[model samples]
Target: MITGDNQHAAMRVANHLGIAPELVFFKASPSDKKTVIQKFEQEGEKVMFVGDGVNDSPAMAQASIGVAINAATDITVQAAGIVLMSNDLNDVLKALAVSRRTLRQ
Candidate 1:
């Protein structure tokens, strides 16, 4: 997770989600988040970014696939390829499942 939140707060949430410290980036500016996604793309990684804030727009536009929550800022939703109507992150999984099923046909 790349977030503008401070390290301490980010780490607390990360730990709860069982995310490794190495994979968590805290206090990242919008540009930093976009740079990280660019770096991953350069390394041949397919990145899927999920966010719901104005600051997340740049990175969201940079990702291979951007998922935005219903509560996201207008800019964020505009930047995303997929917009979830629900606030729950679990909606992302549901969207994925739907996509996979549609693609199989």
Candidate 2:
């Protein structure tokens, strides 16, 4: 998972949900997102990016799928393919579960 200082609070929430700190890559610059996405794409992995901050909107738009919470900024909501009504970080796991199920079908 890719994140930024702007999402530190949310990352803390994600950590509570069992997403390890090692899995989280925190970037302070928006430019870092491109490199992160590129690296994932190079590995042939489909990456879903989620965030509520403006700095993350770009990566969100470029990701295979973007999830934005209702509490997020308007820009993030606009860029996201899935706009979650709930703010709970646990909802992200639900989304991933749904995606996995759909893919299997």
Candidate 3:
């Protein structure tokens, strides 16, 4: 959960989501986010970046699967491979499930 939010806020959100605090990157710049995605790719990991802000465009574009909410900035929408029309974060899981089903066909 890489975010531009401050460390304290990031930690709080991470804790609530059951994500490790060490896995939460706080105060991340756009470049930093992109770098992290690239690092994951280098390590043979597939990254799925979900974002709504203009600042997230770079990382979204760098991700293997970029999902943008319908309410996201134009740049973010353009950078994403998929857009969630409902603008609900949970829709990401639904989308992934559908994709997996489609892939199995």
Candidate 4:
């Protein structure tokens, strides 16, 4: 996860999510998020970026799959490939599951 937040906050969220500390990018700007996605693409990785703030629009557009919450800014909504109707973050997992199932079919 790439975020503009400081290392402490970033680590806190990462730890809660069970993500590796090395995988978290702290003090990242929107452009930094885009760069991270680009780097992942260069490494042959598929990225799914989820965000809501206006600050997230560029990164959202840069992701392999961009997901936005319904309450996000218009710009974010426009940039996303998938916009969740509900603000619940768990819906992202559901969407991922459905996509995987569809792909298998």
lDDT of 2 by residue, 1-105 (tens): 665665677488667767886666665466688578867878898888878878878888878888898788999999999989988877988988998899999
Instruction: List, residue by residue over 49-91, the lDDT tens digit for candidate 3.
Output: 9999999999999999999998899999999999999777889
Candidate 4 achieves a global lDDT of 0.95
How high is each candidate's TM-score? 0.88, 0.75, 0.93, 0.95
Error of 3 at 44 (Å): 0.3
Which of 2 and 4 is the better model by TM-score? Answer: 4
Candidate 1 local distance difference test against the native: 0.94
All-Cα superposition RMSD per candidate: 1.5, 3.1, 1.0, 0.9
Candidate numbers sorted by lDDT from highest down? 4, 1, 3, 2
Weakest 10 consecutive residues of candidate 3 by summed lDDT: 17-26
Clashing pairs in 3: none
RMSD of 4: 0.9
* Candidate 4, superposed: residue stretches over 4 Å from native: none
Which ranges of candidate 2 are over 4 A from the true structure? 6-23
